[model samples]
Target chain A: MMGDNEEILQQAADWRALGKGVALATVVSTWGSSPRPVGAKLALEQEGAFIGSVSGGCVEGAVIEEGLKAIADGKPRLLSFGVSNDRAWEVGLACGGKIQVFVERVE
Target chain B: MKLGFLQKALAASREGRPAVLATNLTNGLQTFIEATETAGDLTLDAAALQAIRKAVTEDRNATIETADGPVFIEVFNPRLRCVIVGAVHIAQPLARMAALTGYLVTVVDPRTAFASDARFPDVVLSTDWPDEAMEKLKPNRRTAVVTLTHDPKLDDPALSVALRSDAFYIGALGSKKTHAARCKRLQALGFNEEELARIHGPVGLDIGAISPAEIAIAIMAQITQVLRAEPQSDREAA
Candidate 1:
């Protein structure tokens, strides 16, 4: 299929098969005016490489950081990010929304 | 990330079967659930398995809570399919539009003159009889069947098979009188009123579509509406 879901999962599977550490970040839930809907995915590798997007460009850098850490620790983490007034401009979540992303190492 | 499970799930995706991959967020334990399985103990309790099955059926991903922990149920639904049982002028635009909407489109007709690969570029062309071709295609719930040929020989057989299958949308191109006659013929062949209700006879929304392209657009819009809206039977019950 042309959708990004299969492609992202296939990428993680391929990276895992190649013995490269991989972490998957999925937008499990969203609130208010999130950029991407729930079930959006962002995949990351051990070397800070990534494909797909969970929040378009708003929180990718932070997600990438969490993804790399998840790959290192092997413990899954649920990350929450929102467009708060103080950090809204800094994180670029101008959509005025919040999202919960579940990041886990692809075992 | 069991290689065997991943491989099987990939194969399922390729083969157009709905599958669910339930992964334990706490421990990374994973297992695959086929469509036919009754949510049995596949590393998940009954409730979580039901949720996964529901997500797979709805073609969406869901997170389920269970005794173990939160499990992310990743749903791998097959691509939506549009099986057009004619290769007329309308079929041209219809096939293209269906493809643009992310549907794997197939145009079937025995007429070599119209069902040419040149006419329907980038669409699966089946030059077999409509019934035989559809049998091979195996229209599922994710499939929408549309019959454009006015000939009963072509359209009826396709509709017969499509009505028997799990195709979500079945539309036949004809006028009100033509559709009434077609319904009578189908009723003579033993189809009941409720089953016949599934077919959108004067196919497409009442858009006053004149040209073949416009008619195709109307049909596509109706298909999309039916797909996104609640099921007619469900809505009626509600």
Candidate 2:
């Protein structure tokens, strides 16, 4: 199905349920090649799977890894990817590009 | 039915749930839209985007009315997120713009000095190695990645990571020369031509932007464009 519409429906329900807190992550900028567009989203919970994205498969582990700290700190964040080949393979990046992820905890 | 999908999807996405709505935009759009229901809260109150939800009948192939704006449901998938790959000047404006659009924004950088709270007062600033950083910041269908730094080292590697995932939008910043050079390098690194097409280099819309703020607007415009996947007919009407 449509990616955003699915995400939107879930977001509305989450809001309706009055989830503890909502955090918004955005892909503000990029270099080289990449997946997701800027302004893409991935919402997180206190402790569970998340919605949205910042990079391809390569950088998600890093994002979720960081999301944990973000929820604990209740602050927002800015993340980055790099232009290295070894790293891409490590995270399964198909293209050689860099990305920046901005995470904000919606108060 | 127009408001049905949009309203329902918005509600679901906010709840950390998932709902798929369909619209006619890209290829295979009809098949996908039909997969999900055109449903939403009966008392939905999206006044601004409301005009876009009218339907001729709940019939399939019914045209989406986007004369007012883009016609795509903001699906209720998971958490709303955005991944910023660089901590540059243009990114500063971009991060703010993303937040305004209701995305959860995270900025990443390896240089602690460049990625300090002082630089980005309101965001989650990380000073970790980018390669290692992306490992934890993996993206899904709802994810988006933008590489702001133009350096091949920073930008290229990050893109490699993004390309391997299902992120919705992937973009890079550079001129024709820079992009050409980048393509050459990527081609040499076992990248197929088709995979490269997913990238939006010379990042941002061609809005004749000059300043960081203007460029930020262009970038946001492009991002919104990809996220909505608005149909050409809707644009013509607008």
Candidate 3:
């Protein structure tokens, strides 16, 4: 009954119901050469289990780390990544774009 | 147990209904709107309600500004459908092609032999009369209807039903002379020129197609054209 994104969100809920903590990261907005469009999502579980993508391999690892943190703290976090900074190259935003992702624990 | 707005939206989506879900980002309050049904128990301010209706019509997803701040609107539309009125040679390929392109294809014909499972392997088959079949199908804006049955009793009834409905596209297979005769007959039935014009007789683009497969290709191309192009621009191009 769910669309692609909703399906992933449902998975998050299902996993949480099974006693695994889960966090959802959603692309709230993006600018200039961002690989994933806005509303793209990624869900991560407490045990390093994850599904879906927020970005094309560029920032998923960092987002997953943030997702895990969100699952632990039970608070939402807004993350911003851009290629303008020197550390962007190491984090995979080499496409000269900026993206704002909102990470929240799914209850 | 009561369902939340998200669960209600999911149920409506699975049923292929036109639905919109609007969420106030700050407060997380949600409004679920089913375009075809009554507003039911949900209540919202005029601005939010108007925005949701607009999003449903446009099939657009967006962030809307309301008195209560920004609301994220997600729109859900049913999958596209193609109802072919004849299980003829051209329809064989047409059904396969439409299915390949993500359409839920249904082949309708009263002739049981032609509408057999062997002919339309994966397609939905209806062996009822055209009018009865069409009534059951209930062609809507998301549906495209093509009549390959040359017989007036068969094709005419289906064409009339489609023309009256909001079906996005209506096509009929025939030659120019045959089309002229068919149009004249419909005009006798009190259909005005504008209504009659909706029928794309001698269906499909002018692609110089001859074989059944080629004709099916042309028909699918024309249906896609009508779907994506503006009516005025399509007329100009035609």
Writing each residue's lDDT as its tens digit, candidate 2 over B1-238 gives 2324435445555554554443322221211122234433322235412322332121111223343322333232455567888899988988888877767788888877778888888997766666667777777766778888888888888788888888888888899899889888888887889988888989889989999889989988888888766533342333
lDDT ranking, best first? 1, 3, 2
Of all native A–B interface contacts, model 3 reproduces a fraction of 0.02
User: Which lDDT value does model 2 have at B45?
Assistant: 31
The alpha-carbon lDDT assigned to residue B124 of candidate 1 equals 89
lDDT of 3 by residue, A1-107 (tens): 12456567567767866888888777766677777665677888998789988788888998998888978887667678887755586775877788877777765
State how far residue B208 of model 1 sits from its true place (Å).
Answer: 5.2
Give the runs in model 3 whose Cα sits over 4 Å from its true position: A1-107, B1-7, B25-29, B35-44, B209-214, B230-238
Worst 10-residue stretch by lDDT in candidate 1 chain B? B229-238
* Residues B1-238, model 3: lDDT tens digits: 0134445554666578777766555554556677555333335678777877876776656677777766666676776789999999999999999987667789999999899998888789999999889999999988899999899999999988888899999999999999999999999988999998988989999999999999999999999898767733532332
Global lDDT of each model? 0.82, 0.63, 0.78
Candidate number with greatest TM-score:
1
User: Model 3 residue B228 lDDT?
Assistant: 65
Which candidate model has the greater TM-score, 1 or 3? 1
Off by over 4 Å in 2: A1-107, B1-75, B231-238
Output the better candidate (2/3) by TM-score. Answer: 3
Which rank order by TM-score, best down to worst?
1, 3, 2
For each of the candidates, the C-alpha root-mean-square deviation to the true structure, in angstroms, is 4.7, 19.4, 6.2
**TM-score between candidate 1 and the true structure:** 0.77
